[model samples]
Target: MTTQKIAVLGPGSWGTALSQVLNDNGHEIRLWGHMQAQIDEINNNHTNSHYFKDIVLDEKIEATTDLKEALDGVDAVLFVVPTKVTRLVAKQVAETLDHKVVVMHASKGLEPETHERLSTILEEEIPADLRSEIVVVSGPSHAEETIVRDLTLITAASKDEETAKYVQGLFSNHYFRLYTNKDIIGVETAGALKNIIAVGAGALHGLGYGDNAKAAIIARGLAEITRLGVKMGANPLTYSGLSGVGDLIVTGTSIHSRNWRAGDALGRGEKLEDIEANMGMVIEGISTTKVAYELAQELNVYMPITQAIYSVIYEGKDIKEAILSTMTGQLKTEDEF
Candidate 1:
């Protein structure tokens, strides 16, 4: 309701798109990216050609390379960096902070090194005295469509309801709607794990499998996701919510998903290195598959789809053979978790 200055740390497609939403909400924005060229481009030309090829940005969205400058006098911070660099960016923000500010991240993927959620890493990185509420923004939304003002709905989840509600207000608009959720664990877990299934979906599509196969992959993927999510202290019902099934549907079905595109290239017989090299963006599901597979094993949860995808991505297994093996394996009675 009030005009505020918000700092968005990251200039990638998602971060850039989210900045546009905040700008549209009558908020002053400080958009930060490490690349000098991109920052200059956004500030001068009002465009990010690398990420959003044809999209023009708002001239009011100030671009910066300095984290301290971005966070200075800002009301809130939105982190939208890669999973690999989440902590690195958070630590920079922590060091720059001299006042309490609301923090939320849209990054979806576990830390491969610690298998920790992005919020967990944020908690460890940011000093409690300097940070206000921590929230996670996620759902079945893509940056490509979001920037174009297409109808989009997402969730702002936190351990504290007020925190979630605050974030819901932070970005809500006619074209961009947000729902508040309390289960940060479920929301975050579902957000990260769905990419693994999406990769599998894209692989199935690339391998010439029809709708039935993709549908089966999604259904079983949700089950596997819920199994692991519950074991990780998440509510089973949250898997049925927007951050879960909703997110999965979009990422698995859309061509805009880098994870799905990477999997498709894999199914097309491209080497993992080659696929990654050419994609030009982080294929989150590729790293998430490793994290989910390891987490499933450590938690003793059954996740055949995750395992098969993991094998194809990490263990040099043929994607087609792995899918075939999963299809022909002995069946077990399914239970709704």
Candidate 2:
């Protein structure tokens, strides 16, 4: 394997973990973050206890607060920041770059204001010619499991097939595997939409519901999101692939999911502000819920599960009441969409 220098923006759990994976693959990585304290911890202690406790980082994975210094000579960059700040960071990177580079983002969510996918936001913020390619990386893998190098499967998607394969090779290792796909719209949509359902799944867990109920939520949630995805011009079959159902299963069930944890807190009758303050990490699903809800309304797509989750999050609806209404309100054909 050819050694490459890569810069990873965001020292969060996901970003840090990915940097470690690339560093282990023999790439020199500059892991950049906004926080000086976090960068200091990573550069000095080789561990970010807040994000990945007890997991030591690769010393080759350099940490920095200066974006220009991190991007100085890197051949590629991974934008692993929160979805909300993805565009902001991309703008900074775009200005700093003097040559074309492979730009891939692992963020999942629509821009709350524009209802734009992360890729779209990247395009809007970064000049087209400066970026050799724009790609998205997504799947069911969690940062907690990934940092330990647990076997994980994910997809690298772009409009350009060759670019997708290049990204696939960048991250794939014995334990971390990536498949290439051309369905960028479907991949991004499925990845973002799954978090809304995962929030609902966490609500079920928090409400003390059992397996039968959770299974029902996952199945029905997929149907609703797929309908919306199809309406948004995604291939219907992509919903059956790894980025769709594969992601929903893991995000909906795992304790590592911030969206699920937020929903769990809501299920236990906590306020949104309280949940956000406690999590420390941004919960993508909460903002994505607002975007998905508005998009469904604007696109005229049927998304009952999304509606229920949105209500529980934004409308201050009781979690138990919201779940009960969502489960009992509609009785259409299973594949009505």
Model 2: residue 227 alpha-carbon error in angstroms? 0.9
Clashing pairs in 2: none
| Tens digits of lDDT, candidate 2, 155-248 | 9999998989888888999999999988899999999999999888888888888899789988988998899998888998888889999999
Candidate 1 local lDDT, 205-241, one digit each (tens): 8888899998999999999999999999999888998
**Cα-based RMSD of candidate 2:** 1.0
What TM-scores do the predictions have?
0.98, 0.98
Which parts of model 2 have CA positions greater than 4 angstroms off? none
Error of 2 at 105 (Å): 0.4
